[model samples]
Target: MNAGALVLVVVQVAVMVVLSPLLVGVMRQVRARMEGRAGAGVLQPWRDLRKLLGKETLQADGTSWVMAAGPVVLLGSSALVCALVPLVGTTTFPLVPDDLFVVVSVLLLGTVALALVGLDAGSAFGGMGSSRHMTIAALVEPTVLVSVYALSIPVGSSALSAIVEARIADPASIASPVSLLALVALSVAVLAETGRMPVDNPSTHLELTMIHEAMVLESSGRDLAWLELGSWLRLGALLGLVGSLLVPWGIAGDVTVPALAVGVLALALKLGVIGAGLAAGEVFLAKLRLFRVPELLAGSFVLAFLAVTASYLVVQG
Candidate 1:
């Protein structure tokens, strides 16, 4: 990587580290306000992180190396996925064919690692949560992959950089019916992937309904801190990927300082809109029952399939 790329990478990573908690805080505050309560400040997640870090970590009895290593691996994988995503106009690293597939796989890897660790601790809730998590993942992953592939069709490559570059090259393509359909499908996938409402409720702590939180109930102190931060970072990364693919406007294709700054601002604006939409959706919709999740995801799959079919027809026409 060149100096400019290196700088951009470092900035993006630092931004993810700092801004992840704020993103979580924003979601929490918005959710609270929607429910008619005076919401906590956007800095609340940061405060929670600080409190967790200051506490002592306790391990479960008979927990193996896998349990201890899970959080670190999860955090590392989250960071790696964030780095691989073309968040700010261009990728810091060179584009690799089929890398987008790898990105999705890495996310699954992290999720599985956390689930295993949860089960390793011998907590009934943890094991139950892990089982539920894998079930959701098995259903959700294909929808995400197919939906993203639908969007990638017009660009003729699965590489995120290629997709972004194609969209930038022809901004009008975003208005095409196929593109619109793909965006809709991807939007649903995003909500599902991020544990948003009508799919998974981020705020729910009830063991019967909780999937993500139940797995982490045994985690404490710095370990919990890392897991929480990783979740936020993963959210931001997924949002950034969607933005890059669907709304490539105002992204800087070059590496100049001014261009980088513009890219960053544009990215922030896109994320802000996404965050608001998520907040609004959560406000309006109730969480779906665990059994109903398959139907929701299957709907996304059909939409994605239609999107791909529509794109092919439009291109051929």
Candidate 2:
């Protein structure tokens, strides 16, 4: 790889490592303020992670190797997603022909790993949570693939770099009606995948309503910390992908000092806006019942399908 690509990869990885916790912190602070409570500092998540890392790990007697490997795999997969995505310019791993599809599938792999680990613990809540998680994943994954494919159709390639390059080469194309519809579809998929409100409640701890958190109920200390960090990193990477494709303005194509600086600033700004919007949505909306999730995801899938059809019609015309 060229130095520019190498530098971009390094910078993107560093940004994911540092900024993941900060993004979580910002969301918590925004949610607190919106709910009329004293907000935690933006560094609160960092402090929590540090404390968790310093504490000792405890495992249940029935836990299997899958339980032990789940967190590592989760973190590794998220890091891989970060590397595959075009954060600064393009991925250093752009030569990997199926990076976009791999990015989507790796997320599913991590989720399945965690679900199996949750079941291995043999806790009632863990099993229940895993079941719900699988259900949600089943509903969400197809929408995510369809939505991404809608964006990929115009570019004629499923690789993330090609999508971003296509957007940058013809910036006006993103404002088309089909792209707008796909953006809306993908935005809903993002919420569902990220455990945001109107899909799943991130702050809820009750076993009856918990989807993501219940699966991690048995995790403590370092394991829990890594899982939480992985979630945050995944969130940022998803939002970054959306920004790169739908809002490619200010993204740097080269890794010169100036370009890298601009890329960092653009990433930060986009994430900030996304974080605030998530917080607002959480404050304003209520979580859907478990049964309603499928309908929501199905709606997104239909919209995405429409986007693909519309794009074809426009191109043909």
Which prediction has the highest lDDT against the true structure? 2
Error of 2 at 309 (Å): 1.0
Candidate 2 residue spans exceeding 4 A from truth: none
Task: For each candidate in the order shown, give its overall lDDT on alpha carbons.
Answer: 0.80, 0.83
Model 1 C-alpha lDDT per residue in residues 161-244, reported as the tens digit of each score: 777888898888878888778777877877777677887788886888888888888888888888888888888988888787
Model 1: how far residue 177 lies from native, Å: 1.9
Candidate 2 lDDT over residue span 172-256, tens digit each: 8888878888888888888888788887788886888888888899898888888888888999988888878778877787668
Q: After superposition, how far is residue 15 of candidate 1 from its true place, in Å?
A: 1.3
Summing lDDT over every window of 10 consecutive residues in candidate 1, give the lowest-scoring window. 89-98
Residue pair clashes in candidate 1: none
